[model samples]
Target chain A: MEKGKIIELYRKMLEIRLFEEKVFELYGQNIVPGTIHLYIGEEAIAAGVCSNLRKDDYIVSTHRGHGHCIAKGARLDMTMAEILGKKTGYCRGKGGSMHIADFSVGMLGATAVVGAGIPIATGAGLSIKLRGTDQVVACFFGDGAANQGTFHEGINLAAVWKLPVVFICENNLYAMGTCQSQVMLIKDIAERATAYGIPGVSVNGNDAIAVYETAEKAIKHARHGNGPSLIECKTYRHKGHSRFDPATYRPKEEVEEWLKKDPIQNLKRQLLEKGYLLNAGMAQIEREVNDIIEKAAQFAIDSPYPPPEEALENVYA
Target chain B: MSMHNGDGKMRVITYRDAIREALLEEMKRDNTVFLLGEDIGRCWEGAFKVTKGLAEEFGDERVRDTPISESAIIGTAVGAAITGMKPIAEIMFGDLTTLAMDQIANQAAKIHYMFGAQAKVPLVIRTPFGGGVNIAAHHSQSLEAWFMHIPGLLVAVPSTAYDAKGLLKTAIQGSNPIIFCEHKLLYPTEGPVPEEDYTIPLGIADIKNEGEDLTIVATMFMVHKALNAARMLKKEGLGIEVVDPRTLVPLDKKTIIDSVKKTGRLVIAAEDCKTAGVTAEIAAMVAEEAIDYLDAPIRRVAEPDTPIPFSPPLEKYVIPDERRIIKTIREII
Candidate 1:
């Protein structure tokens, strides 16, 4: 990868990390309402996959979608405002964290229903095919969604129709609290792709470079009209499913073991080893990211809530 | 076949053909329009042949056939609609819409509002409802009330060829998600339709026959049944007015209320179940909005609260017909 592109990826990962940490802090202060599924550990997959996509290209996200949104060019201020339920949000306070979308950037929005966005992303690919556009869709979902019926039905449709979609499974080992061992007999989630006659691959989700390379191949394949492919990024979430979750169900040693391979630190170390980023350079980037996230939170706090009557608007048309 | 009448040349076509014509015309008029569903393409055409010969005309890409995945079918349409393409997905049977309820009720219907008006779902879900052919509980159902209860979905239940063609054209052109419910029995029924392009905007009710004694509001096949019952009552010196609220979601409450105020009596006949069905909504609307205009107890002619049976006798017993509607009207009047 070029130095400029690698630096860009590192900056995006830091942005996500800092933004999520700020959201966690805001949640504790009661400034953020409802619950949030943060993208603490699984940053590489989003950065890697979305970096390969153009602004016109589409990406469908899951409930844990802030990372995807950030990587797909969503402004921190707008995203923060949306999470704050302010009128200045991307969805004008209508869609909060789980449903935030910026159509201008082709972040086709996120669906709270697990596995539901898979078919929808496939449909966007179908639209690309029908309109004869070179655009491709990157559909992100959790390991748990692979077990949902839509995973099968949606992927099958895309494979058969040869729609331009790359199915990226962020296999975080557990779905809510259920471990992958308790769910499916198969070891690798990518193996499921063979059922639909598509190329399937698994990569280290923590390694941003590896994920970027894997995604590059899959996205290229889709853009060339070779049909959909499944790329499972084996990663782990640093936090619990939601803010309220203690995650006591997870083994202490297992959690610590995965925490060592945190995606942000992994990429940072790689940058350091390559002499691409010095300690001072990294410190400056951290300060810059912190400043951006703080401004976003402050902007959200200062922003006014949408009028109650605004709820009645946009019910139709 | 065409007829020359007072309103220019009118082409008589089957309800099925009318729907097909609307689809064909829309596809020709807009390059963004395409279709996807189970067995809706060439060979199988459609279960009821509503999309027969469409694939050969538009090519396989536009008239795509899909697997028996109702959720994905509707989901794909929702995705395509929000992005650019206008997809018309057929659910084959209205009963099967339950399988895709999440996609319909949760995703497609709510995407526009939930996304803060960022996108619009200009899509159509066409399915056959009602129970005249005795296809049993799985295939035959009048599930329009389910969709009408949803906030964002537009429900169209057209009875005649003219309405089907016009309403369908309007549905295709509109920028909202629509559940276009077709009746199995009405597919073969022929009605006069104009050859030229026309569209019947949703939420508008049409008065099938004008009268003064009573107002009979119906939907889908029940509209034809109400018309027949009105004709019979007209001969008996009881003038019965028949009203068809073509779209249930954007209901023509003013038209129905005006008719009720004029006639001073209201009878609702629908093919769905009696409890909380389309009739219940219309009756409640009238009772709430125009109760003082009512001279007698409001009556509803709807199917009994049971799954449509395969046996002809049981099916006939449950489904509301012209006789049941006429009986209901007589009791109300």
Candidate 2:
């Protein structure tokens, strides 16, 4: 990757990390309505995988989808407004955090149903092939989703048609407080791809460069008319699954161990080691990102709520 | 083309042929239109043969065959539809719709509103419903009411070949998602259809048999049975009007209420279970808006609240037939 690209990736990762931290702060103050599923630790996967996509290419997101939307180039103001339930947000605040979508930026809405978006992404790939377009789709899901029936049916169909799609599995080691090992026997979720007759690879989710390179290869393969590829990023969730989740289910040592491997910190270290970024530059980027986030939050709070009459609209068209 | 045949040549076709013709005509007209379902290709030719020979004509891509995965089939069709493809997804049996209800009701129907209308899911999900031929509980069902209750869904239940062809065409070209209800028993029944291309606008009811004593409202196969009851009543010096609401969601309340106003009596008949079905809604609509016009209590003729059984006699007993419709109508008039 070029120097400018790595810096860009680091910035995107920083944006997700900061955005999530702000969400936690707001949630702590009880300012935001509804619970949020944080993507604090899996920031690299979103930043790296989305780096290879074009504005017109599509991606189906999961409940933990704010990072994916931001990485896909959705405006921060609209995303913040959406999570704040303001009319200025994406979907005009009809969809809260989990359902944010900006069609213009290739974000095809987030689905709360686990693994439900997989077939949707595959169908998008089918649409591209049927329309004779070279556009590809990136489907993002968690490790637990791999156990769902849609995961098998969707990936198998995509493999059958050799559709232009890359299935990115963020193996965060847990599915809503349940460990992956307890849920399924398989250790590597990517291995499941072998059954579908497609290429499968596992990567370090904390390492932004490795993730970026692996995602690039898989995206290229799909774009070249090669069948879909399943990429499992070995990652962890830095916090509890959702708000009010005390995480008493997990051991303290495990949480601390994963915390040491924070993706944002890892990316910053790599950038500094490569001499691409210095402390002063890192501090400067943080300041800029913080300012942007502050403005976005203000925009969200200032935006008006949709009138009750508007709720009756959009059900037909 | 014009609605009427310029040469006065009428086409006599079955309900199955009309559905196929609609699919063929719409697919040929719009490149984005495609069909997805189980056993719908050249090999199996669909469970009912409604899609027979479609793959050969349009190629496998357009007339695609799918596995028995109901949720994936429906969800994938939803995805394709929102992405600019006009997909017509079919569930082999209407009873099997329960298997894919999440996708049909939640994903496809709510996406338009949930996404703030940024996208529209132009999907037509066609399923064969109604009890007949001793198919048992799993195969035979009249579940149109289940879809009608959901918002953002257009429900079309056509009783004749002309209505089926025209409504299916309108559904494919329509911007909203539609639940196209095709009756299992009506597939082989023949009706007069125009040779030229045309579409029947949704939310319009067609009066099958005009009468004066009472207005009889029905849907799907019950429409024909109600007409049969009206014919028999005519021999007894009683006149009844039979109205078939082509689409249930955008139901033409005006036509039904006007007919009831003229007749001063109304009888709503449907093949679905009696409790909380389409009849209940129409009855309430009439009672709310046209109560002053009614001279007697409204009547509803529907299947008893029970699952269809395997025994032929038992199955026939549960379905709302001409006798049941006539009994209800006679009591009302």
Candidate 3:
């Protein structure tokens, strides 16, 4: 990546980290109504992966999808207002957190049902192919979703049809408290790609450079009609599955160790070490990000709730 | 051998042929329309051959064949529909709908509502259901009630070739997702349907046979049975009117209530199970809307609450036949 591109990637990771932290704060203050799955530690994967997609290219997200939505160009205020159940939200308070979407930017909504987004992305890729467009689709799911049937079915179909899709599995070590070792036999979920006759690779999801390089190559291959690929981002969720439990089931050493390798801090240090960002510039970026989040929070708090009667207004065409 | 079959300006055709013709006509008219499902191609010809010679005309992309992943098939269709295309997805048998309930009920039906009406899911899920084929419970089922319960979906249960052809065309062109129910046993049944380009706006009830004593409201294959029972009851000096509500969701309450007020008796007949079924829902509608006009309590003739059996005698015992319809109508009258 060029210096400017590398700096932009670092900025994106910082934005996502700050955004998620604000969500955690707002959620703690009881501003958010429904439950949320925070994309706390896995910021680099979303930023790196979405950075490679065009505005018209599609993406399907999972429950823990705030980072993905923001990285894919969704307005921060609308997403925050959505989590607060305000009518100004992207879904008009109907979808809340997990279902927030902006079709304008080709974010095909989120599916809370684990692997359900896989088939939807593959289908969107199929639609692109049918319409004879060069648009690609990036499907984001967790490691646990790799075990779901939709994962296998979706990958197999995309392989056969050579649909322009990239399946990005953010293997956060634990799937909502259950460690990967407890649920999967294969240590590398990327190896499952062989079954579908596609290329599979595991990358350091915390390293934005590694993920961006890998994703750029995969996306290029797909956009050129080479077929779909599996990219497993080996990362960790810094927080619990939702805003509930403290993730006490995980060992203390493991949690502490993953926290030390936090992607946001790592990217900041790298940018400084590489002379791409100065100490003053880093401070400025942090302050700017804080200002943006504060504005988004204020907007979310001031937004009004939808009228109770509008709930049934959009149930049909 | 007469083309018109003595009907006004329409040719006689089987229900299967009418459905096929509808697909052909719509696909020809709109380039965005396509068909995709398991066993729907040049070789399989759609398991029931409803798509015979379509793949040759439309090619593999238009009449696409899928693997045995009903979830993927439907998910793909929903994704495709919301994006731009009008996909007529087939689920072979209605019983297999259990395999795809999430994509159909949760995803396709709720996208328009859940997204604050940002998108229109113009998708049609066509499936052949009903127990008369003796294909047993897994392959045969009358589960229109399952889809009718979903808020965003439009449920269409066409009983004749005319309604089937006209309604399928309208469903393909409409803006909402539709569960197009076609009965397996009714596919070969023939009726008069016009060949001219026309469409039946949904929510209109088609009165198959008119009478004065009672309104025998029926659906799918049960409409034919009600008509047969109407014929048998006419010999006994009993006038039984048969009403087929072509589309169940946007039900024609005006026609049904009018018929009930005129006859003062109603019997809701369906192939679904008796309790909490389509029959029960219709009976509740008639009771709620036109109770004062009723001469007697609304009766429902429906399948017993059990899985359709494989043995001929056992299956015959559960499914409502002409004898059951006639007997139930006589009691209600």
Candidate 4:
């Protein structure tokens, strides 16, 4: 990666980490309504995969989708406004955090249902292939979604047709507290890809550069019509599943061990060591990102709720 | 290509031909419109011959065929619709809708609302309903009431050739998920349909025969039966109004209620089983809203709450026929 590009990636990872932290804080204070699935430690997976994508290349995200939306170039104000249920949000306050979408930037809406977007992304890939466009779709899912019928059916169909899709599984080791070992006998989620006759790659999701490189190769293969690829990003979440969880199901030692490999810290260290970012530059970037986030929060706060009559406006068309 | 007249007017055509014409005209007009179902294009000509020559004209890609997997068929259509493809998936039989209820109810029906109206699932599920053809219980069930209960879906059941063409055109152009129910018995039945492109809006009910004594609201095959019953009632100087609620979900309750207010009585004739069916819901709505104008209790003429029997006589006994509808209307009046 270029020196400037490395710094930009680090800045994005930091922005996501801080944005999520702020959201967590606000959520605790009852400012953000409804439950939130935070994308704290999984920031590198989104940053790495989305770095190689263009504005027209599509991505379908999961419930933990703030990082994907930010990384894919959705405006911070729109995302925050959506989460806050403001009319200025990307979906005009109709979709909450789990359903935020900016199709103009190729973020084709995040889904609250696990594995439901897999077939949708594959269908988008099918449309691209049939139209003879080189556009590719990146479908994101959790470790738990791998067990869904949609995962098997969607991946198998995409593989058979050689549709332009990258199935990225962020195997965070827990499906809302159940560990992978307790759920499945297999150690690697990537091993399931072979059943669908697709190439699967496992990577250290904390390493943004490594994730980006792997995504680049998979995206290139997909765009070339070589077929879909399965990428399992081995990562961890810093927070519990939702607002209510105490995370008692997880061991303290494992949590501390994973915390040591935080993607934001790793990226910042790499950038600083490579002479891409100085302390002053990093501080300035933080100030700028913080200002943007503050403005977003204010925008969300100032926006009005949807009118009572507007509830039935978009039910049909 | 040529126009012919019978009885010194335009010639009549079957409801099946009207549907085929609608598909052809819509495909020619919009490039996004496509067809998919089991034997829709090639082998058996759509099981009811509704898509007989479409594959030859539009090619297999546009008029595609699929394996007999109702779930996958509906699932794929839902996926395609969300990704900017307007697909019309045929369920082969209305009873098969049970196999794909998850995709229909949980996914397609809720995609727009769940996604906060950011996405539109502009797909139509076309299937033949009702038990008059004696195709047995599985093939002959009426499931429109099932789909009508869903909030985000539009249910259309056309009884005439004109409606078969116009309502389908409306369904294809509309941005909502539509359940277009066609009665198997009406496919060969003939009527006059306009040659021009047209659409019947989703929530409007059509009054077939206007009268002042009792209002009859029916759907699919029952509309024809109700009309026949109206003719029989007219011989005895009984004035019976027949209203066809083309779309069930966004039901034209105003039309039915207004007619009931004028007539002071109501009889909902449906081919589906009576218990908790679409007729029961409409009866309850009318009783709630138009109670002041009612002189008699709202009567529902429908099949018994049981699977359609394979025997012809038993099937006739179960499904509401014109004699039963006429008797019910007379009793209500």
Which prediction has the highest DockQ against the true structure?
1
**lDDT for each residue of candidate 3 in B56-89, tens digit (9 for 90 to 100):** 9999999989999888888888888877889999
- Which pairs clash in model 3? none
Evaluated with lDDT, which candidate comes out highest?
A: 1
For residues A1-317, write the lDDT of model 4, one tens digit per residue: 88877777887887788888878877888878898999999999999999989999999898999999999999888898888877778877777888888877888878787877787787677668656779899999999999877787778777876889999999999998789998799988899889989999999999999999999999999988899999999999999998868788999999999999999889888888887888899899999888888887788878887776666766666
lDDT rank, highest first? 1, 2, 3, 4
lDDT of each residue in B49-165, candidate 4, tens digit only = 999989999988788776665665776677678777788889899999997787788778877876667788999999999887777888989988898788788999889897888
Runs off by more than 4 Å, candidate 4: B1-9, B38-45, B67-72, B98-102, B111-117, B132-140, B305-317
Q: Which stretches of candidate 1 lie over 4 Å from their true place?
A: B1-7
Over B1-333, each residue of candidate 2 has an lDDT whose tens digit, in order, gives 223335655789999999999999999999999999899999988888999889999999998888888878888888788788999999999988887787788788888888888888999999999888888999998999999899989999999999999999989999888999999999999999988887889988888888999999999999899888988989999999998988898999999998999999999999899899989889999999999999999999988899999898999899889998888887976
lDDT of 4 at B26: 88
- Can you give the TM-score per candidate against the true fold? 0.98, 0.98, 0.98, 0.91
Per-chain TM-score, chain A, candidate 3: 0.99
Better TM-score candidate (1, 2): 1
| Residue-wise C-alpha lDDT for candidate 1, range B1-333, written one tens digit per residue | 121224656878999999999999999999999999999999799999999999999999999899999989999999999999999999999999999999999999999999999999999999999898878999888999999899999999998998899899999999999999999999999999987877888888888889999999999898888888888888889998889888898999999999999999999999999899999999999999999999999999888899999999998899888988877777867
Task: Write the residue-wise lDDT of candidate 1 on A170-243 in tens digits.
Answer: 99999999999999999899999989999999999999999999999999999998999999999999999998
